[model samples]
Target: MANYVFGVDIGGTTVKIGLFTTQGEMVEKWEITTRTDEGGKYILSDIAASVEDKLAEKRIEKSDVAGVGMGVPGPVKADGTVIKCVNLGWGIFNVEEELSKLLALPVKAGNDANMAALGEMWQGGGKGHKDIVMVTLGTGVGGGIILDGKMLAGTNGAGGEIGHICVNDDETEVCGCGNKGCLEQYTSATGIVRMAKIILNTTDKPSKLRQIQYISAKEIFDAAKEGDELAATLVENHGKVLGKALAQIACVVDPEIFVIGGGVSRAGDILIDTTAKYFAQYAFHACRQTKFALATLGNDAGMYGGACSILNQ
Candidate 1:
């Protein structure tokens, strides 16, 4: 009678939890504050307590639960060892084993980005595709690669750290990852704003972007939609770097589709269309036809993906 499963997506601010049937339907979902106090010592215990309370409220016995699958904002090895999670104040440890012991159920864990990709593949934008790559463009860039229905977690669980891929060796500034000219430096929300500032500083062209003291990626895209030449140029520049990076990834993983998510993806077709153009321009001829779409699940992707992981197991 193990008909239900639990999915947990842990973030710096909150932990999203979902109850799902074995058939992949999310029955209920809730969130809890991610208390990072005392080196995050209480996080696991809090989650266990929440699960117990939820089960009791639903009048569902533990024997009716399948398992728990979790997504953490860090690299996770196949054996469920978390390399580290600075935001959670966690060091290298076996997250799956520890949580499993607390909840007294089987547990599976993966990088949050990878879990999002799996979620998209299961029921979101990447549905019906076994090979897909998901790119999330928020404050920073993160990616997940799913090939033939399997997450390619590299030896160090950094297989899909596509943001850190060196895109410009000639650049002098350092990225957040301490790498020079990483893709995230050129494609993320902050990156686009940085590019807009560079364009404003280097060019004499009249632009609406010049009027705004604080620019955002959305503002730039909005200006582009309004036919602002400078904003369009910035978008094109972002497209070039993003497309180039994705093309490189395609040559290796050759995913059937690319699903773009995160806050910046709110630009919708403008972002997808521009990036797809660049991807086609730089892509190997064999990959020129690769599909691209926007992620539909938004924040819930991680929750759905966590449940999918347990169901698949």
Candidate 2:
């Protein structure tokens, strides 16, 4: 039986790869620049070459390795068909079949967000949980849903796109997804900054943020942590918007926990506590007891999740 597994997380800038024991322990992790030129034609071949190099360096034989699992930054069907990945300059194609052919081994592929969720469920903050919702609050919000330890990648692979959930029908501004009032517009890093501008413009309240020409989620959260009243209000609104959205999600998935991650999540306990407080207020009584946590695996989560996915196959 194969005793090793490989996890690959392909992103716009880099491809993170991991060699792991079948049991999920990371043997080593590394990354390679993503050559997205020419429709990303060289991406797969590049990954295959890197993997081969790693195997040779470690003196590991192909027979000792299990199939490879990968995470893509686009919607992917259960059959491994990538609908599209504009970042990678890729279009619809059977990613698994192509990659598998290159390595002469089986391969599995999934949405990058879902892969992070699986990694959390496998060994991160959601380690002990069976059902989980992971939200990544970066420049934009990304979401992943895991049920009974399996990824809930919907038919079109658009599942767990919590950021796009329409939370504010009144929003006149269009979201990056070409929609209005998406949850991401209020809960993501850019969303927070957007709200800050709106709030500052309408209110005469004094805020340190008003003095800073360029404000980021970090500055806002830091000010809130220092007891800045206006910043606090921003956080409160963020919590309310995110919490209410997650409550709606619970009515559908009833996940046991919500794991928060991404750059904005570096705000740590303040972010979790506030979001949880609001979650309890809006969540149904049955799901009000759902737990909350911060994802501990960080960027390595996708690699770990990729390995977890290999086991499923």
C-alpha RMSD of each candidate structure in angstroms: 1.0, 0.9
Model 1, C-alpha of 24: deviation from truth (Å):
1.9
- In lDDT terms, how accurate is model 1? 0.93
Q: Which ten residues in a row have the lowest lDDT in candidate 2?
A: 304-313
Candidate 1 backbone collisions, by pair: none
lDDT (0 to 1) per candidate = 0.93, 0.94
- Taking all chains together, each candidate's TM-score versus the true structure is 0.98, 0.98
lDDT of 1 by residue, 1-313 (tens): 5899998999999999999998888999999999999988889889999999999999998899989989999999988999989999999999999999999988999999999999999989999999999999999999999888878789998878999999999989999888798999989999999888887998899999989989999999999999999899999889989999999999999999999999999999989999999999999999999999999999999998898888776
lDDT of 2 by residue, 25-64 (tens): 9999999999999999999999999999999999989999
